[model samples]
Target: MEAYFIGLSFVLAAILYPLFIRMLKIKNIGQYIREEGPDLHNYKTGTPTAGGILFILISVLFGVILKVPLVFLLSLSLFGLIGFMDDVASIYKKDALGLKAWQKFLLQIIFAFGLVSLESTKPIFGVEVSRTLYNIFWIFVIVGASNAVNLTDGLDGLAGWVFITAILPFGFLKQDIFAIIVAAAVLSFLLYNTRPASIFMGDTGSLALGAFLATFAMHYNAEDALVFTSTIFIVETLSVIIQVSSFKLFNKRLFKMSPIHHHFELLGWKEEKIVGIFAGINLLIALTFIVYKMW
Candidate 1:
C-alpha cells in the first residue's frame, strides 16, 4: 500500500515534467548559471529553471490526496513557498543570488522558531533545555540543511540522486507515507534531471527538498538520522563555511571552491564521477546509520 503511493507519484512526475518544461521554455523561465562557477557549467545557463515545481506540486498533492495531516501540509507549503519566492526572484533578476542572504535567513529563522514552539515543552533526554536553545538548534538544522542542498545543486542530477539516498529509507523503515511519496517523486524527476540535463530544479527544487527534509526530521524527532542520511549535504555546507571563514580570516581558501563538488570539478573531476561518488558515500553512511539505529 505504501509503495503504491510512491509509484503513483513517480509516474505522475515522469508524465507531467515535459509539459512543465515546455511551459517554462514558452515563458522563458530559465536558470542563470553563476559567472563565478566552473567554466564547464557556463553553457548550461538558461535551461528552464524551477523544474522543482513539478515534484513539489505532485508531492503536496499526494499528501492531500492521501489526506495527510494539516500540520505536515502546512509545513510543506511554508518551506516550498519560501523556495518558490527565491526561484521566482532568480528568474526575473537573472541572478543566482536571489532574495538576498539576510532576507532568506530571517525567513528561515522565523519559520524555525514557529516550528520549534509547537514542541517547546518536550523533555530533551531528561534535561531541561531552554526553549531558545531548542529553537536555535532547529533553525540551524533546518536552514543549514536548506542551504546545503542549494550549494549541492551545481551538477546535473547530483542533488537529486543524493537526496533520494537521504529520503527513501525513511519511508520503508519508518513507514512514513510522505517520505515515500517525495522519494518516489524525486526519482521520477531525476529521469529528466540526469546528466545532459533537460531542465534544472534551480533554487525551487533545492530549497523545497531542504525544507521537506528538515520538516521530516522534526516530524519524527530524527535530527540525528538526518545527520547520517544527509552527510553529503552537511559536508557540502561545511566546505562553504570553512572556505568563507578561511578566506576572510587568513586570506586563504579552504578548497578550490566551496561546497566541495566544485572543488573537485576545478581539480578536473567529471560531474558524473563526483555525483556517483557522493551518492555512493551517502548510501553507505545512511545504511550504517540505519543498522546502528536498529541495533
Candidate 2:
C-alpha cells in the first residue's frame, strides 16, 4: 500500500510541476533574488517559485487518504501556509525580505503551539518535562526546524535533497509511511529543482518540510534521534548563529556568508557539488543512526 502511494505521489508531482511552473510564469509569480547573496544567483531572479505548493498539496491529500493523525496534517498545512504567505509578501514587495522576522516568528509560535496542543506532558529524550516545558520545547523544535530548512534553501535543490535524507529515517525506524510518501514527492520535485532549476520551492516548501520533520519526530517520540537525522540542518543553522555572534562580539566574520553553503559558493564550489556533499553528509548521519537503532 505504501509503495503504491509513494509511486503515485511521485508521478503526481512530476505531472503537476510543469503545469504549475507555467501558471506561475503566466501570473508573473517568481523569486526575488537577495541582493547580498552570491552573484551567481542573480540569474535566478524571476524564476517561477512557490513550486512547493504542489508537493504540499500532494502530501496533504495522501496524508488524509492514509488517515495519519490529524495533528500531522494540520501542522504541515499551517506551516506551509505561513511559507506561502512569506513568498507572496516577497513577490508583492519586490524584495527578498518577506514577512518581517517577528511576524513570521510569531505565526510559527502560534501554529507550533497548535501542534503541541494535541499532546500533554511527555518524556523528552527519556526525561520527563513539565507540561509548560514540554510545550515550550516542542514549539521551539517546530519553529527552529522550519527556519533551519528555510535558511538551507538558498541553493537549487539543496533543501529538498537534505529533507529527503532527514525524513527517511522515520520510515525505517517506525514504519511511518507518510515519511516515505513525502520523500517520494520531494525526490520528484528535485528533478526540476536541481541546478539550472525551472522552479524554486521558495519558503512555501522549505518551511513545511521542516515542520513535517519536527512533527513526525514528535509523534514517534524520536526527538532525540532528530538531532542525528537532521544533522545537516543543525550545522547549517549553527553556522549562521556562530557567524552572527562572531561579527557582533569579535568584529569578525566566520564564513564568507552565513548558512555555510554560501561560504562554499564563495569558495567556487559548484552548486551541484555543494548540494551533493551536504545531502551525502545528511544521508550518512541518518544511516548511522538507523544502524545503531536496529542493532
Give the alpha carbon lDDT tens digit for every residue of 1-295 in model 1.
6568888999999999999899989999888887788789988888888888888888888899888755466555666677788888988897876788888888877876666666534434445667766677777877788788888988999999999999877555677878878888889989988988889987778877887787677667777788889999989988988999999999999799877999998999988999999999998999899888788
Candidate 1 least-lDDT 10 residues: 119-128
lDDT of 2 by residue, 1-295 (tens): 6679999999999998998899999999999998889888999999998888899999899999999888889877999999999999999999998999999999999999999999667799999888899999999999999999999999999999999998887677888888898899999999999989999998999999999899888888889778999999999999999999999999999899978999999999999999999999999989999999999
Instruction: State the TM-score for model 2.
Output: 0.98
Give the Cα error of residue 87 in candidate 2, in Å.
Answer: 0.4
**CA lDDT scores, all candidates in order:** 0.82, 0.92
Give the local distance difference test score of model 2: 0.92
Clash number for each model: 0, 0
